[model samples]
Target: MADLFFESIEGVKKPYIDSLQRLLKQLRSPFAEGDDVGIKLHWGERGNRSFLPPDYAREIAAWLMDRGAKPFVFDTTVLYSGGRRTAQDSLNTAASHGYTAEFLECPVIIADGMDGKNVVSIPAGYKHFPTVQVCNIFEQAKGFVIFSHVKGHMVSLFGGAIKNLSMGFASRAQKQRMHSDYHPVLNKKKCTRCGLCVEICSTKAATISEPEYPKYDLKKCIGCAQCIAMCPEMALQIFWNSDMTVFQEKLVETAAAVWKKIQNKSVVINALLNITEECDCLPGKNHIIGRDLGFISGYHPVAVDEESLKKTGTDIFEKAHPGIPWQRQFTYAREIGF
Candidate 1:
């Protein structure tokens, strides 16, 4: 069993800096004097209304600077199209989201290639993967810290450290493959068709074949989860991760690759405020579930995520995301040596 350090949700609104400092010290970071620490953060979209506040990040960075490590905010641009897809777009979006020099003292770099293809492979042993893409920022960093906001998802039902890294470090083509699980064959019994799915699909993967009936072409689909999120009649739903055991095992395994490479040089912090129902990558935000769980930091990504999930402890979690068990992350992680 890995050592998991935790603290309760308090002081997020006031004296956040002190709370942050307390947790960082407990984790025993690799922040030596004059180290260039990579502060990996998600700036959300160009106009997201609920991303992590810049003042908190700024305070965290300043704390590190005072402690001898030079810190700068960093994030990879999106693989899918949106506000953070391009380098120019990322900078613009960061500034728009209120991430100014007054807060973060470093520049954000897209880990994979600038085009979302630059990568080095870290061979990994998992139920689903033999190797994982190690991004440039990840490969070159002297130290890493993931400042993630815990949240629910329209697809996965939860997004934390694992999702943050998988999708975060993923290339454009990798995203297409991961989303391949969303090609759900519509259950005709549940079908009211309603034309909502066809309207939402970007590649025209969904079409109306008859009145109150819709058909899906898996080949044409890009797996955007648009039809799944827009359907009102409850007719549009797919098998969640048709091969979930392997998919999630691979998810945790990939996270392990990152953690193992960094060893004690990395820290996972969950800023459990503004807990939204969907990932920041999504175009719109939705419901909030469970009371806000506060900051948790640990050297173990698996341990940190496991600790974070236990903090939620809600019944709606499994129903919100069927067939996907967050606990499986640890089971697989342990087998693969996270």
Candidate 2:
């Protein structure tokens, strides 16, 4: 079978749900009857407006059910303070976003458990990560559907299937590890002393006192970029502790490590609709950079992501997040045989 399949939402009234169904129909099921299939996705952060809707997820769950597989939607806890930092909070955020079990007809779960302690370290043998820790749900599901919303990111330049598989499946500690390469660099000229960065900082690395600009404690920072991403005045930027490409490599290493375990029984899907200037992890409205092209599905995360960038064009992400060595992700993936 071919490795890639695309279903365009253009020229259709019900583009999202209908086109996704067509794309799913073109792929062969990798699961046996009665298998537990996990549908991995990001159901938008608390106030995020650009995440893919639950209607599409419902379609995927229904498709899995029709094929005799029990499907459940899931996402892991994140490293930063937000709606998804803790498992219970993440589930509540998911439910608030209309991704409840009752609506999707399957349980919506947090893969890393309520306390974010359900994790397993897998051998990577890569240059960056000798071992990668991720959610301990690999043993629970016989098959997986990595449904990602392709969009621009502050660090990766673009978020797609590879990111969905990597950070999406990573443990909070692993997420912190991957994010440790950079810290927030404030631009005081643009800062409003709004204290948003301080408020959004998960580790209290960002602090502000009355009549003082925000101060970041590098020692306490986890490099999660929550402050950088949520800064209302665009005052914070990424300051790399090491070479910038190292961050990209770490991102690939984590994804590659997880992929090694799930590749055979998983499918990758990247939705090109709602292509935004920033990732759905951030709250508020993000600028749309592309028209609703459609959904691209494949057997490999790397391939699906590459095709998605090709369809959306790398120039779009580059313009949104300039000077990021995002190409290193692909090169590093190949270097490590990911």
Candidate 3:
């Protein structure tokens, strides 16, 4: 069997769902009958217009059920204040985006508990993280289908299966640890003092008085980048505390740690459709950078993401987020034997 499987949407007479069905048929399943499988995916932030519909997730869940493996769709709470900051808010957002149990034919849940306390620390032994913390679902599900949306990300250049396993499964505190390397720096010339940044800030770090420019309290900032990504005037830029590559390395380390535990019974799939210039975590209509390609699947997150990047081409992401050392994710993955 091929190490990677791809189904392109070009010139196909059938609908995209058919294409995905064909792709699913090609991949080998590692699951045994009656196993509990977790279909991990992002359901888009509230008000985001570019996220992939839940139709694909329904298909994946149905496929697992057909194979006699019970499946559930899940995502973890995020660090930033938004529709997904709390488990209840995240589930509500998921339901709003059509990820409800009735719609997807599976239970939708927050992997981390209601208050984000259900978590476990796993051994990473990597330079950045000697141990990585993530949702405590590793023992409950016998298998996982790492379904990720392939799109541009401001810090990582692109988001794919690697990111899905890393940030997607991370606990709120772990997410903050990975994000702590950078903070928002304002470009006063571009500042409109609209207070949008202050409004979107999850932490009280960003503040403004009646007529003063917005001030960022570095001590209070958790570096979730919500302010930087949602700044309407594009006034905020990333201020890295160390080499920017450190962030990429930390991302890979976390994913590698999770992969180590789940590698035996996990498959990775990257949906190359939507190919937007920004992640679905941001709440606006992001610019589409590539035409709707299709899907790619592989046994490893690194390989699947690398293939997704190749299919989409690096230039698109580089142009979208210049000067990011995204390649470090792959190189560091190899170094740590992930």
Candidate 4:
């Protein structure tokens, strides 16, 4: 079992902050003095308020910096065309979300360069990808901390350390590969060419085929599934093959590869507040399914997520996104010695 740290949601005192400090201290110099450490966070989309507050990130950065480690907050640009599709836009969105250096006392770097094209490939030798296109900054960091907001997801069923590292750390191309197996298939029978898919497609993968028929270009699709969510007629369906389990396994494999690269110089902290039913990738407000449970941190990425799920008192994510087999991530992670 991994040595986990917890701060309960009890007492009048600010035990949450204390727990974070104690967790950092317990890590016991995961990075040497003057080492550059990466702090990964999901700067939530515009109109979305369920993300982990910048205050928590600031505290963590301050703690790390005070300990002589150089920490910088970062996140890769999203694959979809949204407020954070480009690096500049992402940084701007982060600032709008209060991730400014003035507030956090650290620079916010977009791991990938402008247009989300900057990438360095690493050989995972996994079942799906021979090499995963990890964002350049992740490979460049000496030590790293994944500051994840624990929430339910649409495809993977849960978003935590593994999801963060798998999709969060990858370049746009890598993200595409991971999502390739689950691309959207347009159902022509219920055709209603409202052009919602075309308007919402950030990659311009969806287009009208004239006479009210919507055509999708698979080669052009980055697989963000925005069309599926935007379709009013519910005409878009996932191309579910035998590769669904492989998708989760590939994510675990990529995460394992990243852990192997960083070795013992990494930590994962999960903020369990505002437990929403969807990932922060989507824009706008969402319904919260669970109350706050404070924060949990540990060196084991897989174990931290497992603990988070167990604390939910039920398979909340599985219930939220049925048939996703979310636990397969942990199983595969352990199988690869994560």
Candidate 5:
């Protein structure tokens, strides 16, 4: 029900600040001064240096503070073990990025608490999940805002507020449930008797055939996609046709969940920048696939994501990866009337 506002900036210059200030004005309408605002975001990955710069986020924080709204920037721990593993560790990542005690007006808090444990469940309404484990901070905050760095992802293909809510705000168990759909099922015939996948799997989702290559149990898998990423024979593949639609539906349902939970209490804005080949959670820096588009803000998360995708040019990333499709999310969102 919110109009998505967009500003396409070629560079992160004065234009970025102007656009962000404009967005804050738009989002402040239904609320008043002295509200506690929670800004949910992905604080870049461990080694993945492609996330939104702290300087930009700092400006947004300043804008909220200027309006008398107390703001806290936050992100939860990762479902997989790596960077931002604990609340303390996450704090360090934020500090290292200049979102320090000395810089930003308020301290960053991990929404899901330490080790991703803080959560409040919202019952589903004919959706894929029975309930969603949203972190307590997001649930209890007087107001909420999502600051997503829109980019290509291996799972959902494209991620914005909708994807962020579905995956980003979830507890590890909820994340495990969201990611449960697209696991790699190894083919015995394609097995080259190589030991790479088994050795490289972070979750031990696969077991070596010993006489042949490794075979994935699928049951033990977390669908982290590492084995497929490390596959030499290209034997491991997520069940695109069968499971992708399910993944999309879950994303839509989770978006609806986020919308319902926050209702009039939340807004989302996406920064279409550093358009990398992989997620910001990637361990290494990647080349930007697209130009740095600007910022777009909206109360309707689905609409914002839809518009953000259009701004990225209508090319599906699957043509480049041939491994995923982004339309699944939009299609499902439309079907669910988001």
Candidate 6:
């Protein structure tokens, strides 16, 4: 068992600042004096207010700066279409959430470049991905502090420090690989063969045969799944198995790649506030599945997540998101020593 540091909300003598300070005190920072540290956290999506508070992030930044270190809060653009799909939009969203440099007393960086192209490919040597694309920011920083807002997820069942690194640190292309389990299978009966999918496909993966039906060359396909949405006749369908297990495994392997990038210069912080039934990416009122808890920090991502689940009475996320068990993340992370 790893040494997990925690501060319960009820036991906190003071409020946010005090709890944050105590948590920080218990965890050792990998950064040294004058080193640039990246504080990796999610900037809430548009219309979503369940992200980690800016004030708490500011307190961490201030603490780092006080230790003669240079700290900046940052996150990469998301893969799916949303307000945070582009680097500029992500920065704007962060600013809207009061994560501005002036407010945090530290600069904020959009890890991936303008079009989400800025990345460094690290060979993870995993079952799914031979290599994972990590944002350039992770390479630039001497250390990282992952601030995660714990919650339930549709695929992974629970989102915490592991998901934050696997999905959060990866570039858009790498994300496509992790989610490649669901290859689009065309429903030929419903296909009108309007050549819409052929026109929309960038890789020429979907091609029209002699008559009209579109033939998919899985070899050429990068698994982008762009053509699935372009089907006008609703002909495309996904193989809906619980592919989430493999997806979650690949997700953790990517986290291993990120952990390798930073070596031991990383910290995991999980804030058990506003424990929602779903992730923050979707825009809607999150149904509270678990009561507000406190915060936990640890040097190991897996340990922190294990402890977080334990404190929340264990299996809470599993109960909230049945059929999508999140334990695979920690199990794999530990197996790989990530």
How many pairs of residues collide in model 2?
0
Query: Which stretches of candidate 2 lie above 4 Å from their native place?
Result: 181-242
**TM-score of candidate 1 relative to the true fold:** 0.75
TM-score leader: 6
The prediction achieving the highest lDDT against the true structure is: 3
User: Candidate 3 — which pairs collide?
Assistant: none
For residues 191-303, write the lDDT of model 5, one tens digit per residue: 68678777866678778755656667767876655565445565664444347667777777876787777768777789887888778887777767888778888877877
Lowest lDDT 10-residue stretch of candidate 6: 225-234
Which 10-residue window of candidate 2 scores lowest in summed lDDT? 234-243
* Backbone clashes under 3 angstroms, per model: 2, 0, 0, 0, 1, 0
Shift in Å, residue 253, candidate 2:
0.7
Model 3 lDDT tens row, 95-176:
8999999999999989998867798999999898888889999878999999999999988999999999999998866776
2 or 4: which has the higher lDDT?
Answer: 2
What ordering of candidates by lDDT runs from best to worst?
3, 2, 6, 4, 5, 1
- Greater lDDT among 1 and 5 belongs to 5
Q: Please list the C-alpha lDDT of all candidates, in the order they appear.
A: 0.67, 0.87, 0.88, 0.78, 0.71, 0.79
RMSD vs true structure, all candidates? 8.1, 6.5, 6.5, 6.1, 7.2, 4.6
Query: Please, what are the lDDT tens digits per residue for candidate 4 over residues 1-338?
Result: 44787766655244266656666676656888998999988989866778777888988898888889999999987656677767888888899989998999988888887755577888787666677777888556789988899998887887888888888988765665676654778788866788888987888888886686877888998766557644556677644335668788878887877777876788888888778999887787877888788778888788888888888754666677778866688788767677
lDDT of 6 at 216: 86
Put down candidate 1 lDDT per residue, 191-222, tens digits, no spaces: 77677779867899888866646888888986
lDDT of 6 by residue, 1-338 (tens): 44788887776543367888877887777779998999999878876867766988898898889888899998887655567877788888889888899999999988887756577888888777788877888557889898898888888888888889888988765665677643668888989888877887788988997686888898888776556544545577644335888888888999888877775787889999888888988866778888878999988777888888888865677777777746678777778777
Which has the higher lDDT value, candidate number 2 or candidate number 5?
2
